[model samples]
Target: MHSTVILIEFGAIILGLGLLGRFAGRLGLSPIPLYLLAGLAFGEGGLLPLGASEEFVAIGAEIGVILLLLMLGLEYTAADLVGNLKAQYPAGLVDMALNALPGAAMALLLGWGPVAAVVLAGVTWISSSGVIAKVLADLGRLGNRETPVILSILVMEDLAMAVYLPILTALLAGTGWVAGGLTLAVALSVAGLVLFAAVRYGRVISRFVSSDDPEKLLLVVLGLTLLVAGIAQQLQVSAAVGAFLVGIALSGEVAEGAHTLLSPLRDLFAAVFFVFFGLHTDPASIPPVLLPALALAVLTAGTKVATGYWAARRARVSARGRWRAGGALVARGEFSIVIAGLAVTAGIEPALGPLATAYVLILVIAGPLTARWTEPLARRLAERRRARTPGDPAHGRPAAEEATEPAPVPD
Candidate 1:
């Protein structure tokens, strides 16, 4: 009876998710926010909370995070990561400064302590790479000149996670400085070794993982990623980072094949991950934090746009492209939840999770809208300014011409 109930509940959840995804698709929106809302609806203090399938969903959520990072790693080669790190370090620094500070400040103002502040800082710092990638592709902006600038900032953020997660893990565990330092050192060493191996033996690794049979290829890649992720977790380095490194180690055909085969699984589990996050968060906890979350969202959205704009301008992209780049980087999805989930698990401030949830929900829903409209809005504002300027002929007559001729009739 218990098994039957679990099956029924899990099946219902999956069916609901499929419907939500389809609904989001029709609206030309990313489905992340919908998935999150579905989770809330089925979570504690929700409309229809689940009991039997919670454990299963938890396990699936962990796999989702690992697969998400793995797929992200597959999108870039070691050389590309290295190049972006070098060329875009300044922008990365600027991104951190602009986006991270506001969250930290908010946490401090709330008296959540330095640790929660750090976690909140991270929650706000990183943009949703998955959502942004989809938006760019959907809008046919993948080839836009500022896209590289946007990508570079994201790459740097992901690479930064290799170090950041370990520190966060140590902090959450209440480890001493010595222990934390050791963990950090180990993480750095592993990350460096993986990068070195990827750069030197990526093709060889790919050759080893490559198989003509799709089923075999999928099993091997997925199994290897899970094994590495488990080991990294055991070592306090982070499962996601380990899986990411494994993805980086494989190059050429194997990476592409793995990506193609694993995308559906990634999507399925990623949805589960988001749901699991919401499942644990009490919907009742959100209202109290909603205003703060909204304020933080508004502040961070502007900062993200500024980060993108500065980065794009640094790359010599046009003004419109700069706006696009800024707007594109405004979403905070999986990673924000992942970070908050850690703190929530560690028994941090109870309100932190709710605040993060509210914050992410607002931004994730708003991200696509901003990405689609920011550039055009900026253009319109610019045009209006130009029209009021007598020297700009595009919107109005030149200063000299305006003085020499009667004012044009209103359109």
Candidate 2:
């Protein structure tokens, strides 16, 4: 009877998710927010709290996060990551400075102390790669010229996480300086070794993983990724990073086949992951933090736009593409929660989780809308400004060459 009850609960959850997904599709919106809402509805303080399947959902959510990172890694090779890191390290720095500072400043103003400030700084620094990737794919902008600039920034951020997560873990643990340093050293060494292997032996690894049987191929790749992710977590490095590195190490037919087999699994687990985030956030806790969360969200959104514009302009992408790039980078998701979750577990600040939850909720919904509309809105504003200015008296052309260029061709 207990087993049957668990199955029934799990089955109902899946069915509900499927319906919600279809509804979102019909409305031409991403289903993430809706999925999160469903989780909230079934969580504590909701109309019908979950019981039998809650533990199982938690496990699924962890897999969801790992799979999300792995699939993201499969999209690029070690060579791509290396080139992006070398070329776009400056943007990453700029991103950290502009976006991270606001969160830290807010925490200090609220008298949350230095630890909360550091935690919040990380919360604000990283954008949601998963959400942004989905938006790009939905809008067919993956081939856009500016996408490389956007992608490079994301790669730089992911690489930054390898260094950042270890340090954060040490700080949260309140380890001594020597212990922290040692932890950071181990994380760096592991990351460096993985990158080297991916770059030097990617082809060989892919060839070995490739097989004629799709079933065998899927199991091998899944098993290997899970094993590596578990080991990475055990080392306090980050399972997501380990999964991503595994993806980066494979190329050619193996990568393609793995991606094909795992895409569905990634989607399923990713949805579960988002839902799990919402499940932990009590609705009552969000009200007090909502005001601050809104303030921070508005402030960081603008800074993110500026970062994107500067990066795209440096890349020589068009004005529209620059806006698109900025808009694309506005959302914060899994990583932000992961950071806050650490603090919550440590009992650093009672309000931090609620703030982070509210912040992510607002942006995840607005992100896709911004990605879809920021360019058009920017263009309209630019045209209004140009119209207000007198055209060149001596030449038939507009005062700015950018004024007359065609819309950026979609990729």
- lDDT of every model, 2 decimals: 0.90, 0.86
TM-score of each candidate structure, all chains considered together = 0.95, 0.95
Superposed model 2: Cα runs more than 4 Å off: 391-411
lDDT of 1 by residue, 1-411 (tens): 999999999999999899999999998889998888888999988999999999999999999999999999999888888898899999999999999899999999999999999999999999999999998888888777888899999988888888888999999999999999999999998888878988898888888889999999999999989998998888778898888888888888889999999999999999999999999889999999999999999999999999999998888877777888999999999889999999999998999999999999999999999998887788677767988876765666333232222322221
Give per-residue CA lDDT, model 2, range 183-301, as digits (tens).
Answer: 99988888888889999999988988899899999999999999988988888788888999999999888899999999999988888877777777777888999999999999999
**Model 1: lDDT of residue 127:** 93
